[model samples]
Target: MNRLVTVAEMTLRELVRRRGVLLLLLLMPLTFWLIRRDSHVGQSVRALLLGISWAVSTAALFATSAARELEPRLRLAGYRPHHLYLGRMLGLWALGLAVSVPFFLLTVFDANNLRYAGIAVAMLCCVAVAAPLGMLIGALLPREMEGTLLLLTVVAVQMLLDPTSSAAKLMPFWSSREIASWAVDHTDDGYLSRGVLHAAVVTALMLVTVAGLFGVRLRRRRHLRHAPLV
Candidate 1:
């Protein structure tokens, strides 16, 4: 418990110190809100919230602290890797939620509808979907540049083949049709059902991806540990 708490504190503080994370979490959302102020009220707010959530999750995964120092420092302090990873994941999720809530509230108030709750759920769904994807990318390509390029490629593909695109309809998270339909509906029934479905799918995918990444990391660590020393 103490180790997890320490890792969480350290992760949070490290996040605070990163200017890029700060800008992405704060300034970018504010800018989006200002720029889209004149647009359709509900849709604009939904888009802004989605963008902010996506950006924050992506940034958190990529903006890691110096891990080389981390292993030695933690070892010297007698901290376990599992504790550190758990704490870091907790901190990341907390930060993601912090950035998400304000935009959600803005959407709820501006839209002034119970359906806005669906929008909030959808945004969180997207974040859940994106975060593990980010972690998978991080694990596969540990180098920052490689991971970043991979992320950009994926983002590019997603943008080019959004839900409206025929190719994207097959993608789990990209199919925004249900959400879009519910967005047009004033009733909460379709909205809640579709939103919950999306959230469930995303949550499941995230869990699976996290498990895969953990397995890969564990295997690689074991291989390295057993390697003949020079």
Candidate 2:
């Protein structure tokens, strides 16, 4: 448990040290939020949520890719696979929440009569889903470019699709949109319920997938057995 916390803290330190990357990541969501600031409040907020999801997932992708070589060494040094991945996830989730805070505050000041709580829930869903989704891609695709392209494609499809379409529900960030609707449009509780359900299911699925992949990759092999000493 302490090891996990230590790994998470170190991961946070590493991200904080990359000042340029953190700034760029922060700029994206703010840009999206501000782009529609004058035209439509809902659009700006939804865009902001999308950008937040993208930023965190991209960070997760790069973080996982960067750690690929280092993880084996960490394993040799007595860390388990969960210690590495879960700790990294903890760091990424904290980073995601930090990135989200200002945008959330933006809604507080910039918009009126909004269900701010719903927006907060939507953002939570984004952070919950984005990290594992990105990690899964990073785990499956060895190259950063491949993982990035795949991530972009998913977000593109998500943007272009109609939210009511059955297909949009398949997108990982759909819950954010649904909950955003509840937040901005004053839709009934059904939207919030569906969004929460989707977020839960998707989060669980992605987590299981990531754990399975990590377990397989980090497992001990039979050939390296040690003989008992006399």
Candidate 3:
């Protein structure tokens, strides 16, 4: 537990130190919100949620990529795979929440007649789905450029695809769009329930996949020899 917390803290510190990246992270969603603001309330809100998901996922991708070499050393130092991945995920989730707060406030002040609770839930779903999705991509593709391209492709497809289509339902951030509909359109309770269920299932699957990938990657490698820890 202590080790997990330590990793989480270290992850947070590392991200926070990247001032330029943090600025870009904040700006991306704000730009997304501003782009759709005057068009329609639903579009604006949904865009904001997507932006948050994209930002968190991109951050997770880069974070995982940055830690690739260091993680092996940490494993050699007795850190388990769960400690690394889970701790980093916790930190990313915390960062996602922080990024969402300002935008959530923007919605509250700028938009009217919204089911604000539903918006909050939708953002939670975004953060929940994004962290592990990004990590999984980063794990599978060692190159940052490749992982980023894949992330962009996923987000782009999520945006262009029709929400009512069956294929759209397969997209990871679809839950955010569904709950955004509930929040902004006042559609129905069904939307909220479905969104929550989808987010829960996706998060579970992605976390399990990430755990397996990290476990394999972090296992003691035969090529290097080092003194056993005392």
Q: Give the TM-scores of the predictions, in the order they appear.
A: 0.72, 0.97, 0.96
lDDT at 144 for candidate 3?
Answer: 97
Query: Which lDDT values do the candidates have, in the order given?
Result: 0.60, 0.92, 0.94
- TM-score (C-alpha, index-matched) for candidate 1: 0.72
Clash-forming residue pairs, model 3: none
Query: What are the per-residue Cα lDDT tens digits for candidate 1 across 1-230?
Result: 98888777777778878877677667766676667678765456544654664565566556442453454466457765566556666677666777778776776565554466556566666566555556556656668677767666665565456455567644445523345346545544654575567657765766566656554444334434545788
Better of 1 and 3 by TM-score: 3
Model 3, poorest ten-residue lDDT window?
A: 218-227
Tell me the TM-score of model 3.
0.96
- Give the alpha carbon lDDT tens digit for every residue of 73-102 in model 2: 898899999998899899999989988898
lDDT, residue 30, model 3 = 90
Error of 1 at 188 (Å): 6.9
Better of 1 and 3 by lDDT: 3
